[model samples]
Target: MTASRFPRWVYTEGGEPDPRFTLANERTFLAWIRTALALIAGGVALEALSLPIQPGLRLVASILLLVLGLVSPLLAWFGWAASERALRCGRPLPSSRLGLLLAVGVAAVGVLVLVGVLVGPVGR
Candidate 1:
């Protein structure tokens, strides 16, 4: 879908909220995209590195990171949309559930990588 066509769900809701809040939401979404891009890059680098690493474990770590990265943008959109819809509807803003999920995901990835470094095979 086109960039413009994306986030079409935003328009299907109630009337516009404050511009500042909308702008804040847009900024938060952009930040999440940046973070997702970084995670993908880290995953790629981990997989591509020439340093010694066990194939299966490194691959697992790589996959975990990559998957998290891929999921984040979608979460961002969902979070942003929900918040916007709430704002328009005058409902309480939703909690930051995505943040906790990401935190846990990142911690898991880190643990996997650490284990890979400490116990997995080195250079291919």
Candidate 2:
């Protein structure tokens, strides 16, 4: 209930005081969840398409999606926590290295899949 608990001024006119910052943070978290779901769907599609699916490679992709899905909510919560703290303390939001890390990881998996398809058995 205290002003220190949330960023209410981020949303108000002239920055006099508002709750827009918290609102924005919530929106961001929702976007992350959507991204996680998309990744999961991609993994499912890979499995459904009968890709080479060598046990190890398939497992990697599946685990990537599963981990992403599992971590999304946790990341979102952390983001909210940081946002709240930043707003209260009048400090900048925390930097996020995970976004870049996730992007690179996903790209790596895609490349692995491509390589597998190229080198895999052709008569399957």
Candidate 3:
């Protein structure tokens, strides 16, 4: 039995390599899973808060949170796939487009919330 030099299967149609890359890939997958779970948690927390919230606001928040939760995992999977491909190709890691998009989306959501607060009635 002999360990291979490069990350296998990636280079050849069917080959094996050091386990380090495999472990790294597993870690990346776990990170993505955690991210996905966090998004789901956020959705649940938002819905939970809705218990005492006005129906309309609660519904809107719940919907938005659920969308975030559902999308985060998909985005994570897409990003991970691209990253893994880059690793296999030995190319410089792809740009952080996903991170930037997430950041922008979050900021836009914050702005929308601010607008809602400002445009809506003053607190009771």
Which candidate comes out best when scored by TM-score? 1
Model 3: how far residue 87 lies from native, Å = 1.7
Tens digit per residue, CA lDDT, model 2, 4-122: 53444533313232478767867887888787788778777766676664656766776776677677667766766666667656778897535875787688778767766666745
User: What digit string (tens of lDDT, one per residue) describes model 1 on residues 1-124?
Assistant: 3235446676566777898987998899899999999989988999999646667778888898899899999999899888888887778999875798789988988887787777758543
- Order of models, best lDDT first: 1, 2, 3
Q: Model 1, which residues run further than 4 Å from truth?
A: 1-8, 120-124
The alpha-carbon lDDT assigned to residue 89 of candidate 2 equals 64
lDDT of 3: 0.57
User: For residues 1-124, what per-residue lDDT tens digits would candidate 3 score against the true structure?
Assistant: 2225333433443334346764676587677667657767765775575244444554465566566667767776666555566665666556644566556655655555555555553353
TM-score of each: 0.85, 0.73, 0.60
lDDT of 3 at 25: 63
Candidate 2 C-alpha error for residue 46, in Å: 1.9
Whose TM-score is higher: candidate 1's or candidate 2's?
Answer: 1
Question: How does each model score on lDDT?
Answer: 0.83, 0.67, 0.57
What is the full ranking by TM-score, best candidate first?
A: 1, 2, 3
Best candidate (score: lDDT)? 1
List candidate 2 segments past 4 Å from native.
2-17, 52-55, 122-124
* TM-score of predicted structure 2: 0.73
Model 2: per-residue Cα lDDT at residue 73: 65
